[model samples]
Target: MDERIKEFFSWSDLFDYMVTRQLSHIRGNWELTWDHAAQEYEAEEDSYAELINRLVIELSELDPPLKYHDNEDRLAEYCKANLNWNIHKIGARWVGSDYASILEQGGFRDVNAGDLCLAACGRVKAALDRNQLHFDDMEEFHRKMLADVVAIILYHRSDQCITKLS
Candidate 1:
């Protein structure tokens, strides 16, 4: 709807707005818990971990294609590793952590995984387009490019997405 929001929906924009928004919602919850626990020292110190764990689970439930064992592991590792730590640094690093590497590695040659991921990305792009989330030709193309990339990734992994192309 908004231009800034449109910019974020671009695949070439370097961040997935939907995912970012979801993460932000999680962060807001985490902050609320942190504040609550800070005021109540006797509060369970494990509350943050529990919240993160739940968020990770929730994120994994978004789309079957996006859901993976590695997704849970990566999110858990990030929550555990960065608890009570620097928010900015953790936020920046969490995105590029083993979660993606794991997805890339496992999705390779795995038709189910690749197809799922590509489909999930496609759904996201389509939703964005329907919501008027494009800034220009470049942005529109960017979403398509992401879809293409996912398809290529699927092809590279298992020749499923590009059976005819290859």
Candidate 2:
């Protein structure tokens, strides 16, 4: 019912799927892993962008529109600038959910399937070492990356929800 909850649940298969990617990579099938993520993005185009755009508008208009709010414009620009390049391009491979953090780290490196698989190895190791099976990093990655992807993949499907943004 809640928008954030809906977003959270939208990627219910993320963790396990990441794990699956890890195993496949171990088996020397890294391309398969990247392909899965790429397909997911192909399925994404413009849908999630519309969702976030609406959210920014809704939140900004809570009280007759906030004074210092141009979230809509900013989001639009974000979509235009970031999403313009399709992930399906030659060097635009899926670099796992962790690549999402590279922005905050000021490390603008391109993450590929190998990087994702290696990160998977680390997460898997952490789980085996009794760390909390956390997806915080991945979740943050989803927020930034998916929004960017959707924004780039423009479409007019404005009134639909992948699940329900209610």
Best by TM-score: 1
Candidate 1: RMSD to truth: 20.3
Over 90-140, each residue of candidate 2 has an lDDT whose tens digit, in order, gives 243323223333221211221222222223233323332443333333445
Q: What TM-score should be assigned to candidate 1?
A: 0.27
With candidate 2 superimposed using the best TM-score fit, by how many Å does residue 27's alpha carbon deviate from the native? 27
State how far residue 136 of model 1 sits from its true place (Å): 7.5
- 1-166: candidate 1 lDDT, tens digit per residue: 2233323322333322322222333233222222233321112321222322232233234443333333324433444454432222254244443434433443443444434343444444444556644423334554543434333342343322111211
Candidate 2 wrong stretches, greater than 4 Å:
1-111, 131-166
How do the predictions measure up, each by TM-score? 0.27, 0.20
Error of 2 at 157 (Å): 23
Q: How far in Å is the alpha carbon of 47 misplaced in model 1?
A: 51
Model 1: lDDT equals: 0.35
Can you give the lDDT of residue 117 in candidate 1? 46
Model 2 clash number: 1
Error of 1 at 64 (Å): 8.1
* Candidate 1: clashing pairs of residues: 109-157
Estimate every model's Cα lDDT from 0 to 1: 0.35, 0.29
